[model samples]
Target: MSKLERNEILLLFDVDGTLTFPRTVIKPEFEEFFYSKVQPRATIGIVGGSDLEKMFEQLNGKKILEKFDFIFPENGLVQIEAGKEVGKQSIQEHLGEKTLQRFINYVLKYLSELELPIKRGTFLEFRNGMMNICPIGRQCTREERNMFAEYDNQHGVRKAMINALTREFADVDLTYSIGGQISFDVFPHGWDKTYCLRHIEKFHNFEEIHFFGDKTEPGGNDYEIFVDPRTIEHKVETPDDTRRILTELLGL
Candidate 1:
């Protein structure tokens, strides 16, 4: 397809579990297929909860900026278009230091008191747009991450923590989202994946916006954009699922 023809549609994807496995690099075969076949048919973009650096580690490193037409890291709090950063937002700027500290302190206390199967360091990760709170810590090994995912599924640890946070910070205009296998994100209202649409709309008009993500259930980080009226949503379970849908939809 010609560039003009392809630009009429946007294929927006979530990083983890959509384009690649959770917190892992994209497979070489899939990467080659995506760049060689899939990317040629439409305008490609990525909206991920992780910071740009992490997105880089998983999706072709610094070259990612050149790969995707739109790169929305930190849920578009940090926006890059055509290899140039166009916009950025900061959680510290949105929520004053006093409130931010209070929230952090409260989360630390809650995590400290709560009992988990195991605990490691870096429980509270402050990002450009939000704070990622991991009860088992982000430094856990791959096996441990999978273990906690199973444990949280059966025990509802992350859900319960989100519930507690929702009640405690009810008046703070915040949104707590559960994503990936390990942690939930805390950000101001409207900072979810849908935030990227604002930037996309400002620059181009597309006939269709198709979003593919795994965590589209309620309170999942992808929920807002998945259900948003503007885009057609595809709920995928794995990178293979995403590739299948893309091939079927675009006839690749």
Candidate 2:
């Protein structure tokens, strides 16, 4: 880790399980530390994989968002400014529409024709310029959703899916990310926290930057952003840790 100066940080935090409690939003100490201690000293931005609506809901809407000057929402696809969306990047940019459509249609066809004891979630979720696909069920309970993740390990479905697609489509690249229980965040081969931070960092030149998140483990969602050389990682375990990390960094 880098024992860097606190004020010279451009802090970025992942919301689910990091700032907000996992599965639900109930983190008071983090909220207090964010709004009271950290928000004033350094520029803060929430870099999460959640959709726009869910992002606002988790953050208590525009009021909380207004605290930060900018947001890297939708897993770094959509850039929001002052509560208004300003830009977006779609994973499909790497794939032609016709080609992507063909693959998506084929997946849907196979899913409909074949019967699996374990069900799947959303196959395609299109929003803005981006298109997301969850090989399992969408909007299902956490238990129902978890089946998909476990399926990846037991049946090797997730890995197999990526391998099959990559083999079939040599010109296209397909990758999978564990987003929550029932989600596979398919983005460009290089769409990750580093890339996301590159985009966010260009706009704001901060003196210090820190990252607070949960899924930093390998193959977990926070892998990309957590290990940034300029970032201070605050692990999500107890609210006290979040507060302590922030206070210690800020010298509060």
Candidate 3:
């Protein structure tokens, strides 16, 4: 692993399985610990496969938002920079509403046409516009969830069907990033999870940005970032292991 000076480090954590354990249960326990570690941090953010509204809804305490400077929600397609939402006047400089609306509408229409049952976990997974098309289209049962796990083992990476979907919608300027389970992301050419880190780096001036994810293989999203040390990184495994690594490498 690479090292960072503690004083200069900016902690950006991916939610879901990384920061929170019991990955399926987005509950109070995880939020409680999240608040405990994050409240005092000056520079931090939450980068997850969720929209801003969904992220806020899942938040366990007010303190989580009170402390973090940004929420790179919807992948890198949206950003809540320095405590400001993506739209509104102040934060409008980096992203545009027209583009977002087009993308959002396209997705909405696309999914509506499919007319799948939309439920918790059954909806799209996105952050900063890093979008994931869940196989079941929403939340599912234990048995149904296995399909995604199976998908990864058999058809994941850049060549998977999800990747083909991006190609199918090639007009949208999309790309694929294999995420957890059967989830796969569709976002702009340079704006995947790794790009979110790089975008943050460009704006914030970081020496390096370290990433972590449960998925990494031939077509894994973080694979490219993991190989590069200058702007991005991809850690393979649980958040606790990630924490252990940061503790030793950066003396955090």
Better of 2 and 3 by lDDT: 2
TM-score of each: 0.97, 0.79, 0.65
- Per-residue lDDT of model 1, residues 128-246, tens digit only: 89999999999999999999999999999999988888899888979989989999899999999999999988878998899999999998999999999999999999999998998
In Å, residue 146's CA in model 1 sits off its true spot by 0.7
lDDT of 3 by residue, 1-252 (tens): 344443345666666556654235445554554455433432566776556665665564444556677677655456677677653111123345665566556655654554322323555654434556665554676566665466546644324455446555666565676655656666666665565665665667765455655554555555554464553454646656655654565434
Error of 1 at 87 (Å): 0.4
In candidate 3, position 36 carries an lDDT of: 59
Best by TM-score: 1
Q: What count of clashes does model 2 give?
A: 12
Q: Which stretches of candidate 1 lie over 4 Å from their true place?
A: 1-4
Question: Residue 206 of model 2: what lDDT?
Answer: 64
**Model 3 misses residue 203 by how many Å?**
3.7
Candidate numbers, best TM-score first, in rank order: 1, 2, 3
* Local distance difference test, candidate 2: 0.67
